[model samples]
Target: MSVLYHAVRTPVRWAFRLLTDLRVEGLHHVPSGGPFLLLPNHQSILDPLLIQSICPRKIHSMTKSTQFTQPAFRVVLAGLGAFPVRRYRVDPQTVRVLLRLLDEGQGVCVYPEGERSWDGALQPFRRGTLRVALRAGVPIIPVGISGTYDLMPRWLKRPRPGAPVSLRFGEPMCLGAIRDRSTRDRRLPEFERQLVREISRLASVPISRETRERLDAGSASPSGEGGS
Candidate 1:
């Protein structure tokens, strides 16, 4: 961890916890070392900070490219080891960077739901995210963050605080090396369903109707979460 990460982590975590009654579970599922991916849902803008505080491993997060355009915020984001990614369309460079980090045995976090939910429900994930995990061939941990939306949702300009929050890390999921194009295409939906199920279980939240429909339709929408 960088000196800045160490310097501000404790204070940020302490304040965040105090504000939201933050708690974590299934932390043992987080590997002590080596590369892994932390896949979580997006709720509040604070979700990344909350997850980073609770996660035992040092995590590099994926931030929206627009957020990086701001000089001041960009500096803070870079200091905290976050990288920018274009959310609306496919970005091959983002995939390359994520793979590089995993190949180097560093932990990375990506909110599978490309954006925060307007109604605090789970959104459909980008299919490419699953592909990345399968290609990296490392432990993929699904994280469930509850109560952030209530405290500070995307629409909420300020945090209300006092809402209880929890981070639940699911057991490591391994898709192995999915090299065959035909087989991967045929079974991608099944893998996606498995991840969605795990995330719902850990979070104790109902999957949105959109998620249900999207899964059944077997489509990867352009706005689906992953790089955002």
Candidate 2:
């Protein structure tokens, strides 16, 4: 990890834990060190930061290009190893950067949904996301982040802290060799759909029974403790 990563990570972890009842599971699914794609559901802007906070390795993320407009913010993002990608457009440079990072044995994060969900539900995976993973021939780790949608929904002016949140990482999946092109067009959508199903399932699963118990206890408190 870079010095800047460690510097920001400590505070990000502490803030989430203090602001909300945060729980993470399936962390062991991520390899200790490797080149792979980190795919996560996007609910709020917090999704990327949350993912980076818990990951043990330095993660390079493809952030929206507009975020880089500010000189100060751009510097901070660059220091943290983030690159910009123009959304809803074909940006070959972005893809090349991502593939190069993966080839260099570094992890990169991408939101397959292309954009955050407005309704706190899983959005359909955007086309071509899986193609990137397949081309790189790297294991793809699916991460599901729940509760952030309610905590910091798009409509909210700011996050309503104290909400319970969970982040779960699913097992690494390798998209075996691509079959010959005789029927690839028909098979490509199937591959993306299956991956989407796995991500959606992970999103719905709670962090654990223990987290539910904690939430139950808090709600059952005499003072009526509850998420904000």
Candidate 3:
């Protein structure tokens, strides 16, 4: 980590710890070194910052590309090790950047759910996140967050102070085990199913077929109304 990153992250970390009474479980599951991807379920925007606070090592994260266009926010984001990701479309530039970061032994955070669930349920894993993992050649650490959405749900002005939050880190999964099989077009469906199953297990939340159907039909709430 750069001197500037530590300088900025330290204060933010302290603030989040104080504000949320954040509690983390399974920290031991995280590897001490990197060249790994952190895949967390997306329920609220606060997910990224909360993950950063609990993480033992620095994490490079993908933010909406629109965030970097603003001059003031751009400076703040850069200092905190965030990079831009175009939403709803696969931008090759963003993929290249993420792959390069992972190859260099850095940690990267990707939300496989694509967008936050409006009704506080886990959604299907987008195939794009898996693509990044396959190309990056890094192990994936599945992280599960609970209670953040309730603390600052969409349509709230500010997060309710003193809300309890939980973050759980699951065992690391090696991409190499499935890479060869997934490389063949015939095995794509099986690859995606297994990937989602692993993530769901790591999350430790039972997701029923009915719940998945509901979430897929639901729409995400507007951005900025909730904490990121």
TM-score against truth, every candidate: 0.93, 0.85, 0.81
- Candidate 3 per-residue lDDT, tens place, 1-228, comes to 777677766776787788877778888877788678888877677777788766878888888888799899898787778888777565777777887887788998888776776766667665566655655567777888777777776556678867777788877777563344336233334545665566566555556564456345542221111102
Alpha-carbon error at 186 in model 1, in Å?
2.3
Model 2 agreement with the true structure over 46-83: per-residue lDDT tens digits: 88888888888888988888999999999999888889
lDDT value, candidate 2, whole model: 0.76
- The TM-score measured for candidate 2 stands at 0.85
What lDDT does candidate 3 reach at residue 32? 85
Best by TM-score: 1
Model 3 per-residue lDDT at 117: 66
Q: After superposition, how far is residue 48 of candidate 3 from its true place, in Å?
A: 1.3
- Residue-by-residue lDDT tens digits, candidate 1, 1-228: 888877778887998877878788999999998889988888899888887777777889988899999899899899887988897787788888888988899999988887888888899887777766666778899998889989998998999989998889999987776666556666677778888888888877789999999898876433322343
Order the candidates by TM-score, highest first: 1, 2, 3
Clashes of each: 1, 0, 2
User: Which residue pairs does candidate 2 place in steric collision?
Assistant: none
